[model samples]
Target: MRSTIVRIMRIAGLAAVVGAAVVAAQQAPPALVSEQELLDGLKADGSRWLTFGGDYANQRHSPLTSITPANVNRLVPQWTFQTGTLGNFETTPLLRDNVLYVTGPQNVAWAIDARTGRQIWRYRRELPPNLTACCGLVNRGFGVLGDKLFMTTLDAHLLALDMKTGAIAWDVTLEDYTRGYASTLAPLVVKGKVIVGVAGGEFGIRGFLDAYDAQTGKRAWRFHTIPGPGEPGHNTWSGDSWERGGAGLWVTGAYDPELNLLYYGTGNPGPDYHSDSREGDNLYSCSLVAIDADTGKIRWHYQFTPHDVHDWDATEVPVLADLAINGQPRKVVMFANRNGFYYTLDRTNGKLILAKPFVVTTWARQIDSDGRPHLEPNQMPDEKGEITCPDITGGTNFWPPTYDPSSHLFFVNAREVCAMFYAWKPEYKEGERFTGGAAQRVTGSNQKAIGALRAIDPVTGERRWQFEYLSPSTAGLLSTASGLIFSGDADGNLLALDSRSGTLLWRYQMGATMHGTSPITYMLDGRQHVLVPAGTTLTAWAIPAP
Candidate 1:
């Protein structure tokens, strides 16, 4: 009887071990992210948000309709995750496999559980003491592929981290941070290559965009925003001016798969606001360039605000779409420029289809037929100062705008403010602020600064409707298929607006403002969730389970 009992016990132990192994295998993730998955963009199931702009088109529009305008007011906070760091979030978080990969200020990142808002892994970089990050010590977000996440550092380096464990897979330096070069843009992954741009436009550093091998961290090609000696646009800048021209690209751009081109808007020239400092149009600066993704060659470019002196950097996001203009199907790129112009251009050859003022543009009344601005008299700034309508921040800044393809409406948070701009000759000093100008906000009884969330008809350059704010808001925007637009006021109020009519539907005081980040939505556990990053905390909201 004892021998028989021992035999049965051994068999039971073996069966238990085998059953545990089977369960583990079943629970494993499907596989690392595939190329086709990235190309698929946002799906109907709402399973992931794999790219920065939700897709290559840079349209922050989601297809999920569970959280409709009628039901969005019913959302309740599921969980809140705090950064516990110094600065605020300027990132667009990426979601995959029920996990959120987010990058925050001061080079800190986290992988959190989508279900519970729990941190699964955290990654932080030890930055140097004298870092010269001009804008803020912030990281936009990560670019993911296979098993790794790619991020640009404030110390001018690019790193690939293991998505599962947040371990550094590879690290490569883009430039010396001490020379006033820093990178804060999110990496954009396209076809086995990671593309990123350096930021130091205000510090007298020449700008360039780089492509690196995603697997090995090897640089594939470099495209200088400022043309070189033999380059085509080299003559656009005066002698030796192109060496330190500031066409830095700190904002993420859109990509077209069929054209195999990357569209990026460059920054203002160095010594900003002083026209004589760079005597020419400053080729590629304050312009949009269509670049060959495979060869890093410039295919075409359209300069908006050529030789801009109002500190207008064309770093605003470029959105792509296919529109039927005048009964002709046209593939076009739309841009609301900081120089106070809204433009529609042929994405194929960079030809202007239509250009009009979306705000109070005093510098120019309109864009001429040949795509040049019809400049107004005495608008340029000098030592005595000149009052410009859109101010130095322009009508809209670097914060993103959204596009709804179904409704054919483009939305942006616009500021209506004027500024007195003053400019003088500046001396060049490496690793120091190089702007030779200043802007003072115009304020008085009739000139109060105000903001509005405006829905624009891109085809006609007309305002469909606008929801006004008490103060000028710097927050980005997001839209959904269920007819909801998410935005934040300067006063820490998160708003849900009806996308069609711009009617206020719901408002919640988030306790902090979403500075330059837009809220993202996805479906989790059969409930649609809106993930918002405001101040230093990330909060997830969803409707109650039925």
Candidate 2:
């Protein structure tokens, strides 16, 4: 009788503990709002825009239709605030209440009044002079939540600032910038957690996405792109290739709150030209991985380029949308991979719904039924040399693309070009840092048609329309419900195109190439205005009151 009572008491105690755990999990703070609700909120009121791409769908689409195509001709410069910096002005200004938060070179952040454009406060992050940057010194944007403005520094530090007064709340180092890891992308906030990805895939850093507690700077979790020994996908890499594998998650990702999944694109495997050292399909690299936001577990993945030989890193932002496919409404995640192929997958299950070439691609003959690319064996880089179309860059799209839900068309700026590639055995020396690969490059004869803005149908992978430019495009794009598409060019032209058809509606030259940032639209004092940070100045345009 005593033994039975003890056993029953222990079992009851265990059940109570399990019950408490279940209740605690349920009582935890509510998960972030669904992606659709976030998008709807942005479209409803143009106030309190807290994210880099305005609510994570990253459509860059605004529902405010006050500035239409008809009156866009009357647009005039409202105000321009100069940051007095020298690098590219790729900052996307975030509007909250009536204050605007922006970021620039060296991770300098400014809080200004949205209506008057007067400086409220400024947070300057002190960075090392010897910082290594693969590209120019540029930060895409910052994130706002409650009373904090979060951003990443050039030296790979994530800093949070007080929204009202520019004071540092928390400063945490993201990576060792000395080891070639730096962060330029904005910190994405989801469910009270700040999510960030590391850049420098070319500099030979293993890629991963990290989540940090919003209130405290403690790390919540990390998801490594390259698997290690005893890991589930370790077999994908061969002979210690996992040590230096390059799968950097440089860009921001999209989240689906309905399914509780975060979709992020991974970059290429390292050693750029020489893939002989790392054989087999490098799992997770050059793919779109769907991860659980709370637990950081990879739910599913779709690889765009397995064992990518070229330097085509799949670092572009994945856009989410609901579209009619085969007479059924399917939730889809669309991305134009750097390898020159546009892919659409079922956002819920990682099923490849469609895949098509968006640019001048010659390496792969076609994307097979199982969503794998059928390479033309000769197109792979050789020990001697091989001429590859769509070079290290890719077709027309490199930066973030915009989607118009009204027209169901995806707008992308692309490059029509190719390159000559030669892979050689890398010479490694002990105790000296090296990328472990050798390469020689030659420009192709048909390296022209460098820039073209194309409108594509993500459903069919068809080009609805295209706008060609004299120079290759490096800037990003934005769209609005007012039937306007905004993008910049390498020639320094900030242009507005008709959303339905790719027609040039308006253009303004800012005197320098627009690189790596998208335009934004907002309402100030009951008047809609378009804003683009060019070079070092934030320029705002509005229809002059007549």
Candidate 3:
């Protein structure tokens, strides 16, 4: 009887321990994000979105196909999340493990439940009063690795927040905001480094892209967009122009794991339209730079516009892909540039493979065989103002584009607009607008500034098909394997088009335009959800269960 009682007590103790462990497991946090998962890009399972461009290639294309062109119309709103802040979202929210990590305007961020579109934790930064952020007070997005989320502020600082609690892990200053430096792009996480760049091109701030240690906020290296005195591209900038040359990197870029290279597009030169003050090719600015990921060295660069005078920054998104061109396999970086040209460049060496106009380009007829543009007469802006096609926004701006590998097509929201550019010699002051010129949209009877969502054959630069928007759209794009391309109109309509034919598959009025943001899709609870950020609200859409 004594032995039986002892055995029963031991069994009871074991059961109690087992019960405690089960409860602990239930309360444990989700698995921390791994680098392999980020390298996986958009998986077939549609589990998570780990990066800014949905993958390092910056494809913005997904592999999920649950909602195809046929049933995309049936997508219904599951839930809506409002920022309840002053500014709209200019960010591409990151998703992992059914939780959304989103950044908003005014340095506000949140961690929300992916299944319910409910807020889990929110972060708001107390910005300085004397901010000289050139554009809107917007943050592009967040980058995550392990349990920390990295973000850049309008006050020119990079912060790593704890992924679980929205608490700041560490913060590092990128530059001083009072001196016209601000960081707006989403931090791109590669390997174990968090890569980011600064803005304030209009405020005469020299721009540089920096990589930081992911665990600590310590900066690893910085590559100045404007080359220094003894740098190889130094001669490209005559006189002291390279100091505030304004090669701002306000958009996220692509990464190639095999090459270990980060490809980023640089912004315009300072004194934007008056190139005479700072002459020469202005190396790096208005260019696409390929940098060694481990080292802050430029492997090679291709300037889309040499000595750019029209305020056209080459800050458009770069999409990397491997394609067969001229009957040969080619590794290429495709760019729909703000200079009204679409280029396919050999990614390995920064050589131009092909260049063609995707819009009404009057600045230069075409890029010559030597990779220089054939300049048109009287295209330069002057005191009297000169008219140029593509206007100041070029053919497109910073809105993210998408590429569908299966379709062999590149998609972008393009604008057909022209502007009268006026330039003058302006005095430079610290922490002030340094653009020596301005542009006015041409509203002549013959010039109608309409917009279109165009699908282009990257190999031939030929238009496959296009859907016209009443006005130029500032929305980014998203494409899926199901032959659906998601876009937004300036008139506040969310649209899904047939990727193969540009047919209108579905449409919904979101009441506010997407502006500089794009919709992201992922799987939640066995259902595919499309998250749309228009104005200040994030609305999740999914088809009702049958």
Candidate 4:
């Protein structure tokens, strides 16, 4: 009888504890995300990483200095999280309050415990078998605001998922997949609206940037990259060329809150090499368009390639920076373009400040004072192939570069190579690739393609320093105030370098090259952890506790 009484008292005590926990949870207010928090970027507090570029400025510079060059070798792996999927990661993972929100290939997403590397919830999509997403069936990342997360799908849809649970709150179709539309961009959430762009320039689709109401999933506005009838630059394309003029804005762009403008770099025009199919300067394709954030209207645009026959998509990342030039502070946008050019433009109004070649560019001699490319004769693609410097991939591709505002330096992995390009008339089908040309890599014993990590002054468009690799690297970059810059080579090596001198400080073979992936840093358990997503695994490294 005494044993029974003791058991009843023990059960009652357990129930009371459980009930108290429930009451406490209900009374505590949920942590709400604020706009200022996003603007703060990667702070020394090391709490969260909410955006793709780490900030609206698209500066991937972190202020953490706990792990310096002197003790970087002492850092060891804390934990590893694997996707267990087939494809490698091209997406950047986001972190909040000890939980990681990540998007993977084929629209697989997860919210995982940052400390234990265990998944809290996972979201997998039922993708269409006949999906026409060009390049790859991959997602970039997620944008979170106020207990909700946003992601763009391979089937051209934007989905809002609950933060705590991976359940879909709402899904809105951006465009029909059958119409050759796909969205791989990480949605940019600004001013209570989610901003995104479609990727299908090679498939002969007209690309546009769309804004959706974050709460209701209702589309707020759409700004077509190509001008329609009666638009200012409509005549730039002859006849119906503008109908399928392929001005895709595939990559994520930078936002300037003070200017209320969102700047995005556009993709190559369709019939990619057939010059006659689209005549005159394809106004907006292969350009950077600054649009009003509130209303989807183009403020001004600067065309990188006036009438490009090469497949060099201006889809390379655009980084925004404020620089002082000749004793005057100027708001500028920096771009390391794929067409072998490094450009610095006045962001407020699209005006060319400086344009210089970072690689061997054979098609254009130079940019004229009036911002026109002086084309070289006999360089256009035809039935017989023509060799071009910097190849079809240009100097770089969509892999993001980094900027150090303190150093006034922009860092990019540039390719030094050439390719033989061939063109034929392409008959456009509903969901078929519409690129009229293809490029063959020019290679031999003596001829080789190589890559280098280049640091250029944003003000002068001149090389500050460079670190060469055996081959071109598609990896992205990260920098810190600790005088360190993290990068990866094509040979499966994660590298750390001095930010000012470009001297190698440390190296680790991650088994796979970063391959369009970047290393993100944060604080965990009182230690700073560097997280790298290479291949299918996320490896977290930290210094051993003293």
Query: In candidate 1, how many Å is residue 225 off?
Result: 0.4
Q: What is the lDDT of candidate 3?
A: 0.88
Per-residue lDDT tens digits of candidate 4, residues 253-348? 999999999999999898798868888998799999999999999999999998888888799888998889889999999999999999999999
lDDT of 4 at 374: 79
Measured with C-alpha atoms, the lDDT of residue 136 in candidate 4 is 78
Give the range where candidate 3 is weakest over 10 consecutive residues by summed lDDT.
1-10
Clashes of each: 0, 5, 0, 0
- Which should have the higher lDDT, number 1 or number 4? 1
What are the lDDT scores of the predictions, listed in order? Answer: 0.87, 0.76, 0.88, 0.85
What does the lDDT read for residue 454 in candidate 4?
94
Candidate 1, residues 346-369: lDDT per residue as tens digits? 999999998988889999999999
> Per-residue alpha-carbon lDDT of model 3 for 1-546, expressed as tens digits?
001111101111122221122122232365788888888889634878889899999999999999998899888887777777787899999898788889989888877777766566677788888888887889999999999999999999999987777777898999878878999999999989999999888888888999999998888899999989888989988889888888899999899999999999998999898878787998889899999999989999999998888889999999999999989999999999999999999999999889999999998999999899999999899899999998998899999999999999999999999999999987789899999889999996899989999999999999999999999999999999999999999999999999999999888888899988999999888888899889888888888888
Q: Which residue pairs clash in candidate 3?
A: none
Steric clash pairs (candidate 2)? 395-415, 396-413, 396-414, 396-415, 397-414
The total of clashing pairs for model 4 equals 0
Worst 10 residues of 2 by lDDT: 1-10
RMSD of each: 9.0, 14.2, 9.7, 7.9
1-546 per-residue lDDT for model 2 (tens digits):
001111101111122221122222222232233334443547667754667777678777788888888877667776667676557667678876666778887676676666656665566666788777676777878866666778887888888876666667898998888777788887788877888888776666777899998889899999999988988788999998877777877688888777878899888887767888889888889899999999888889898999888878788889999999989999999898878888889999999988888887889968999989988867767666787767676764337888889899888888877776766655433212334433343454645556788898988999998888887787888888889888888778888888888899888777666677777788877888777777777777788666
